[model samples]
Target chain A: MTMTRIEVSKTYKLFINGAFPRTESGRSWPITGKAGDTFAHLCLASRKDLRDAIEAARAAQPKWQAATAYNRGQILYRMAEMMEGKRDELAQAISAVPNGPLAPARTKSAKRPASRTSSLRLSVSPSLSPAAEVSAAIDRLVYYAGWCDKYAQVLGCHNPVAGPYYNFTVPEATGVVAAVAPDQLPLLGLISLLAPALVPGNSTVVIASNTNPVPAAVLGEVFATSDLPAGVVNILTGKRDELLPHLAPHRDIDAIFAAGLSASEAQMLREGVAENLKRVQIHDVAAIAAGEQGQSLEHIRGGVEFKTIWHPALA
Target chain B: MTWRSPTVDTVMVGERAASFTKRSIKNATKRELLTLALSMLDLTTLEGKDSPEKVRGLCHKAMRPFERDEQMLGVRLPSCGAVCVYPSLVPTCVEALGTSRKVNIASVATGFPSGQYPLEIRLQDVRDAVNAGADEIDMVISRGQFLAGKFDEVAEEIRAVKRACQREDGSYAHLKVILETGELETLDNVRLASDIAIQAMDDVTPSGTGDGNIDFIKTSTGKVQPAATMAVTLVMLESIRDWYLKTGKLVGMKPAGGIRSAKQAVHYLVMVHEVMGPLHAGPGGSNPWLTPHYFRFGASTLCNDILRQLVRLKTGKYVAGYDFSEA
Candidate 1:
């Protein structure tokens, strides 16, 4: 008879307001693998947890938005560096998911475009190797990091009006944003959704992928180790349906990025968003994963509000 | 005469306070505790930019905390215990809370947040606030004197301020001597200051004056860190409990600053119940120390948090920060 020692596993908790607090309700659900073996016990967050995250994001957004754009770019780049440092851990977590390595696309275009605004040729799909996915995520972060301080120059405009005025439209972060991660490509999907929202200095409260949340929970360390200020990117692990309804109608949340919501879930979110007139965006994650939906300025603009200022043209 | 201050074990005080946070409060019981905590708040605004308009806004908030969302919910929310402001701003609060005697007017005097001024001026500050229709005066003690081991001078100053809290017609305004525990440096100093204030107020206050006894012993001025930690408040509450045991007069306890949430406020309440419950039982086996007359929260933002909780309980929807106006 051979004796084997059991491996110790870490429990995942909700990240809110700069702290990893267990769910105030003290509820936990087992996250199972393909063979029906429990991988970990993730916190089953309640509505109160959602409320607390929103409050933290709202409180932190103003200060985050006030930072200089160059500084914001530096922090996003630091996140990319943190992700780079934790490559092996993230790859292992992503590969552990069942059916994680689907039919791998044979293309190897995981390189940064020579020109800014040139299309990124990332081989993003379920079959993409975990290393390639993590590589794409880091490059994608750097791609947005290069855009953070420069987006305003491209998106902003000085309009020629009939009157003597300095009329210009500038972009400002829409206060607090809520992002829902996709289940299939947890690591890449989370990074894609979060990079654009954070590029323009918006603080986000993310609902991590329910089925494969270890990748997202692993990214919590990425966020903490990076210089991203506390509460800028809070992550919660729970059932999407249980958390989405509360995040949808929250008046403090200015915009919601709920990817892969079903037709019914979409309708429910739209109805809830109407209560506060919040900006809601639903994305096709599969299309993005197939190299079709690489993030651009529009995804960045989606998390921002345009401010048109008219100053008197004085000599 | 020689003087002695009771010995305080910081480790014991901290351990006792930490035990209270472990008590489980939930569902209906949690909601009830939140409601009780809301009623004990001294909605404060002691800023250098204090204005009559600001004080009036705070008074309105103190009186009707959930006014913005009351009609939609069809539930009546309770008013806080008092509107606390600067001495010159007491008239504004008094006029703002006019005819609504349910909310008392409290003023922070004695060179508030920092008690560095001379005794005569400090006492005059207390007198001016009381004359301006303030029913309670929150006076800061001389931390410099207390730290220098001049316990006699510290005690005498509290007595003089208590005397100053008396009005012309023999009616007394309640006095709350602030220890500014953050500046006291150590838990032993915190305990000694609390003991000195309690003894001084007890000596000056007539025995068994019913509701007119030396009103409260407060924790901080809200301008310092380490303000109103459970350990500091536990030491103060223990001092009050001991005084009550000796003189049979219940003294209220107030922990101000850095206590912004309903959870922290309820923990303070639990500590009070465990420490002072036996001596201060009200009707229906309830701890009388939980009420505003025997306990109060010196807070500015706590009212809105409690209002949000109340509205959330009434309607299943959580209220946003914008739903409640600033105090």
Candidate 2:
């Protein structure tokens, strides 16, 4: 008798409108491991994918903004819970790339002795381990989750006027947001940019790290299992350079939050901002990796618009 | 006269209809298709909360779909085929459209969406709209009666409403019979209902005499789920083709509701061109059904989407929904 065994490989697909779908363009790129063997394939999202993701984000923005602040907080907390449950899976995906930007910090320290010349030239900052990165991502989600219902109060204020009128300014969700995840610290950088935009009730279409997108793809799974509404958080796994040109000039996207973009990419985004007057916020990779600056209230403020209302005051 | 409608081949029809969507229409031809689709729209507002201002806004949109057309696109778009509304709003449409007559006024009558009302009352509804200056009457067929196999009663009611579409001046308003195909349940039923509507309208006024304004057989009332699927529309177009071939009498087609994108509109046009023929007389004789005089799309949201695509073609930039007027 002859027996055959087969390995069931995972097919990483794009998360669009709350469902997993292959790229409409029918294109895929291989993800290689440290041994230079193709371990998985990721969908190479096209302009059409960016269009669809923006459409989904626009459609979901109104309802997501309409949801009570408390409910939004609860959903964010639920996302954190889901992330906590998927901690082991996320760490494993991150650790798969031993020399990639998302590799655990200790791996680089362990490999330091073998390449003394390279180590001498390279400045190495202490980064989190895979397990620690996952934990920080979860904590970052909870941090923003707690800020959801309270950020508006802290950001909005009443203005004292000389006339018999009451003026008040309040921050509202800036509609659909497009985010570019950092190539370094893929999971935490993505969550850091994503959580702030989400805290203001803005629906997001995030382009995951091009080189190491598996961790972000796994985060999409966590998002699906959580109570977040479909289209509210669409994740596209593709090259940021290919998608940013389309994302910048998109008329429907109200704001863009990108991290670790090259000078040319950042310049292209800033130029495209002139098309629709959409706000573009670019952050340094070091700032995002610092965790302190990335998780601040000012980051949350980047994805909202201030609407000042004037009402007649009665004596 | 008694009529026997042909049964539709469901599988073949589905395959044929799906093939039309696979055609890749590009650049100049795509722009032309988008412009033609813009001309074929029936910008409609059929809500109970509809106001005179709303009807006027719809008429404005129907007349000039894109206000910046000349400046941005460098060509003025053709006005939409008509502005469809409830019977009560016909006078407002007449007032808004004025005497330019660029856009026709189409009113939904005969207890629209559900023709369950009494026949006499439904006929009066038709008369009221035509008298108030509606150029077209979109009357709903008695679906309940048609389903109960009272085909004669349904046909008679349609004939009565077509007659009611006549004004004192002896000019007849083109009648569109809505079969509400979503409730019809099968492609065979859709074909039969299309035949019944075409024959009933022709009994009052003979079609295909090059009159340009022929009667139509529409697919849905825009209130039902699964309104105007391609398979259902194809069956109705086939009914029209067979009628034209047999008696040289042409009937129009309108697939309202659920058609909201420019890409889908292009597919419908492809299906129409292949199943019916060319738009006008050239080397080959014209397929009259391809013209706005014979084809229409009853949609409110479809207008902005077509405009978005047209702008994308001209300016090379994708536009937002809010960039267009909400009406």
Candidate 3:
């Protein structure tokens, strides 16, 4: 008799309130690798988890916003440094899936494999290696980290009014933000959406990619080891369709940044946003993939609210 | 008074109290509990900055937690147990509540939050509050005496305050002696202090006025850090249970201070129902401890949180903080 070797798969959990906890609902779904092998199990979060994350974000937002912009910049830079250290690990997770950052789009004429095991060895050309995506994500975070302190100067303005008033408008964090990551370029896409939101000192509850979630789950390990405060950024891995209904209508969420939403899903989200008038920012997945989107200061500005202060210049 | 304080297992008391919070209360019972918890609040304002204006605001909030939505929610927003204030501010609250018999006026006296004054002054403090039309007088027992093992002295002082609550017309203001258990330190001392206070005031000279004997035993003055913790409250409730079993006189329990959320208020109700249910159920099989008369919350912010939950349940929408007026 021959003994078969068994591989130990990773157990991925929802990172909430600074702790890695299983979903309160006790439900999970399997994430299959490109080779059709089960890679990991991701926590299927519930509405209650979303509520808890919002509460944690609300509790931590004030202190985070109170921190000097320079300190926030330093923290973001540290996160980039952490990502650099975990470069190899992140690249491996992203490359595990065929529909990931490194892989080219699957064509209709591609040859089909006879067996599921042999399908893992499909002949596919690389568009970009997983290392490039991870490197781009780090560079993107560093870019946002530099913007953390400088955006205020760029976005804020000294208003010219008719009175003897020294009037100026400054940007402030828009409380708790909710972001949904795109499935393609899971790690880099998440960083692109999340970094801009955090640069303005806003706390966020992010939903990692539903299809390619291993890289996002791995990023949670970096978030934990980094000096980022607990609850500053929470990460959950699950079906976007299942989580959005709960996330959209949450009264405490100040804004939402989602990618690749269907028209109906966008409409449904808009209706939910109508209840609280939450700021909604949706990105085109294809544009983001083609590097045509998400490098602007508009993403940071979307996560911030403006306040104008006036002082008597005469006095 | 031969009733002696038993040695309390602090570990056991803590474990038992924690078990009460774990009991899952579902829709029907949860709604009922929330409403009852709302009614049990002693909507309080005890700061040095309290004035007629703040007391008036609190009184109005006590009457109408959600001015328009209370009726829309289809639940009669039964006024809270009382508006608790300083003796000087009681008259202002009384005037603010004005002709509405639904709410009572409770005044804290006896060097409240701290019983450091001379005995004569503390007694006069109780008398002045009663004269100010306080339906209930919350007096703090002298922890200095209680901690000194002067058990007899502590019992005598409670009796004095109880006597001071009496009116010339044979009606008495309901007396609620606060143990200030946070200062009592250990669970044993809390149990002992509760025993002494209950035993000293259980002699109910039947008043047709319903101003029963030592109407309630409160846990704190809300000024202490560890005010009215569940572990301490359990020991006190257990004392009430023992006193009732021995003499058949049901004494009320008030766990005041630090109980802010609606969820916590529900947990306290659960403890009351389970601890006092077997002995003190009313004629209709209702848990008698569910009423403001038998059980009360000495809280300031709890009512608004309860109102928020009530609105959510009825309107299916969570209300913003600004939706309700500041109390």
DockQ for every model comes to 0.40, 0.64, 0.23
Highest DockQ scorer:
2
**Chain A TM-score for each candidate, in the given order?**
0.88, 0.90, 0.87
lDDT of 2 by residue, B1-327 (tens): 565888889999999999999998888999998899889999888898999999999999999898999987999999999999999999998888888789999999998878888889999999999999999999999888888888888889888998898889777888999999999989999989999998888888874445545699999999999899899999999998888778877788999999999899999999999998843322368766667878899888989999999988888777889999975
Winner on lDDT (2 vs 3): 2
* lDDT tens digits by residue: candidate 1, B1-327: 346668888888889999999998876777778878888989998888988888889888888877755585575767899888889998888788987478999899998878889889988999999998999999999988988888899999998998898899877898898999999999888878887887787677666456465468899999988888999999888888887777767778889999898888889988888887876446676677878888899888887787777677766676678878897
The TM-score values for the models, in the order shown, are: 0.88, 0.94, 0.89
List candidate 2 segments past 4 Å from native: A1-5, A98-126, B207-213, B278-284
Q: What are the RMSDs of all candidates, in order? A: 6.3, 5.3, 6.4
Q: State, as a TM-score between 0 and 1, how close model 2 is to the true structure.
A: 0.94
lDDT of 2 at A242: 76
Q: Is candidate 1 or candidate 3 better by TM-score?
A: 3
Candidate 1 per-residue lDDT, tens place, A123-217, comes to 34455688988998898899899899999999899999878799999999988899988766788888888888997889999988766888888
Ranking by lDDT: 2, 3, 1
Better of 1 and 3 by DockQ: 1
Candidate 1 chain B weakest lDDT stretch, 10 residues? B205-214
Q: Order of all candidates by DockQ, from best down to worst? A: 2, 1, 3
Clash totals in order: 0, 0, 0
